[model samples]
Target: MTAGPYPPSMIGLSDVPVSNLAPPTGALVALAVAQFAAISWLGRRCEPALATDRWRRFLDDGNAPLMTVYLWHLPAMVLLVGAGLLLPDLILPDAGLHWWLIRPLWLANCALILVVLTRLWHRFETVRLPALGTRTGPATALAGTGLAAASIWYLWQHGATLNGAGSAGRIAAVLALGCSLVLLACGQPRTRRDAPVRGPELNVHPVRSGPAA
Candidate 1:
């Protein structure tokens, strides 16, 4: 990481053209292969820890809000960096020894912001909305899913706000995405165990509730 092409000496990759990123050759290819091998070896060594309760819970909690973490990390960094611009006198250059010294401070700030963002939206990760289990529901869900995917693709390619123009397209995309979510929440399938039993003759189960009937 310290080997980056930073300031006073070289142009950063972000400033370079896409064509400049040539495919890996020779030593680079060997390095990539070695990384893969190392990862496989580490995974094998870590596998046994999964059986332990501590590791299991750690993995479970970390994974449950992973998408939230992934989505907000870059945004959090952007927010912090943008705020830093307000303190022009105190801010350091994008590279150099002084800038490198503050790297840990930047990472700490980003981590705090990410934690708050994750707390704000983590409930959505485990949300369970009731959905119809009928054939019609499945069809509607599929249609909505397709529409949502198309809208996301368009938005991703053209930016979410669209340079503050094409209000109609933006509105349509937002509406389509919202409708797709509704369709998904109200039309997704349910398994047999999720269905309620009906027209039963008797409550024969000894542990049945309802006034000890």
Candidate 2:
């Protein structure tokens, strides 16, 4: 539901009906405040549990690879859903039948492909400047940041149109952008000879004679 000139599509998951009826401003404000308060209470209650070792590790592990999932999940889902739509008889299960058997396999397939792609593209997210003091370092970082931002914007704008001719191009562009960002941030790999070396230390100890003068 939406207020003013906005459509129900734009509002996303509202209590208001799909009809043209507009809720009062006071009611909208009250609902929003109530929602916020509920969220705050939930967060406070969950904080301690979320901070425990198990939860902490789960969050860390999930977060480490979440960027890859976020980046590729849409395309993967689109491809899978498109296939199911194109050949429903061959790919998708009948309504309310065999879904339990097919769903797990479908989910696993998606997860496997995503994991492979994530591994392949992981370097970009882990990019680190070899030397921040170098002129190239700052420039590379800036360029990488800009490219990453552009890729995100492109995805956000064109995500719904994944079935179009431009979908492959969009995927390729994002992949290239991610790789280029890594190259810029990481620079050239350092050789073994270039690694810092520590020289051996010399020690001197005074010797005492049998009978000191």
RMSD of each: 8.4, 9.6
Worst 10 residues of 2 by lDDT: 10-19
lDDT of 1: 0.72
User: TM-score, each model?
Assistant: 0.62, 0.40
Candidate models: Cα lDDT each: 0.72, 0.70
> After best superposition, candidate 1 residue 65: deviation in angstroms?
3.1
> Candidate 1 regions off by >4 Å?
1-38, 92-94, 123-127, 130-138, 188-213
In candidate 2, stretches whose alpha carbon ends up further than 4 angstroms from where it belongs are 1-5, 8-39, 85-116, 123-213
lDDT of 1 by residue, 16-69 (tens): 422112333344556579999999999899899777999889889889998989
